[model samples]
Target chain A: MVRVVLCNCPPEDANRLARQLVEERLAACVNVIPGVTSFYMWDDELCEDQEHTLLIKTTEERYPELSRRLAELHPYSVPEDIALDSARVAAAYHSWVHETLSDT
Target chain B: MVRVVLCNCPPEDANRLARQLVEERLAACVNVIPGVTSFYMWDDELCEDQEHTLLIKTTEERYPELSRRLAELHPYSVPEDIALDSARVAAAYHSWVHETLSDT
Candidate 1:
């Protein structure tokens, strides 16, 4: 099974993290979507901030490592690390992801 | 359980679709991440395009309707409608999402 991990980071850090993930074989692909407005509560106060959302693709086998590495590298002490299980994926894309991750 | 549906749209139509999804109670929140580059295969040819990725938050019960509506509203003949099952969510945020959808 494959997982799509979602994380929000500041724009400055987005590209670097995405590249590192791929280079380190922690993720097969990381799509960086820039200019996102995220709303959440911090210190019991609602806050909004501009961020870049990363769609990180990897296999379930590699998720734990990815999560740990992400936490270590992410700028935030407690980054928004959410894993979403992919119910379905295109056959070609799924194979591609598996191949990319396993190539290491 | 709450779900995060992923869909990519042209920049021009992103905000409208996001608004309509929320207005129709199909989603509790829709985070529009602009300036995304997606690579895919069409007719055995690889293609890349700029798009806006939408992180749509909704519940499991409402997924079918949301999917149907998204297909109908999306400009592409075959849109990327991938649903990711949330493995875990913050307690406060989870409650907020449930409440927002249930209020309808």
Candidate 2:
């Protein structure tokens, strides 16, 4: 029931997005990983860029809104927003995530 | 199916583990994210530590070996090895990942 969403953005936008997501209750916590080099294809051309990756943690129920808001706020026209379902989560950490998001 | 495995380790071991996993073919690529502050509970106590998070990209079929090798090489007695199943991936990137691991 937990989802960790992966998103890569420019380094300048990293902290702003992370703070907004957590503040808006769209995510319980957001971990920003800086200076990641991502290599992928865009328009049939290989592209590589330095980015800051955001690890957004939220529950299944909040994911839809989180995804929507992320798209609306993201700088890119089509940002990478991939959700990964956690196979196993530590009980305490899981509880904390739920509680933090629910304590609205 | 593609999976993104999350593992947190000390800063000193990040590049070594990332390179080892990729070189050993357990993972197609590993992104090292430095200076992650993780707040979790261990032994009924709250612990906050700075860690380097490794975003390991691999196939579901190759996960067992990756997990085993990660545990063996990690410095922590009980390391965090959480696998998240990628709900969706870009076609080109996904193909590249599969091909990279399969070429061995």
Candidate 1 residue lDDT tens string, B1-104? 66988899999988788878877778876778877899999999999999988888888988999999999999999998998788755445567667767765
Instruction: Give a tens-digit lDDT track for model 2, residues A23-64.
Output: 999899999887875544334343456789998999887888
DockQ values of all predictions? 0.25, 0.21
State residue A37's C-alpha deviation in candidate 1, in Å.
Answer: 1.2
Clashing pairs in 2: none
lDDT of 1 by residue, A18-50 (tens): 999999999999998878965443443445578
TM-score of chain B of each: 0.94, 0.93
Worst 10 residues of 1 chain B by lDDT: B88-97
Q: Tell the DockQ for candidate 2.
A: 0.21
Error of 2 at A40 (Å): 11
Where does candidate 1 stray beyond 4 Å?
B5-30, B34-84, B88-104
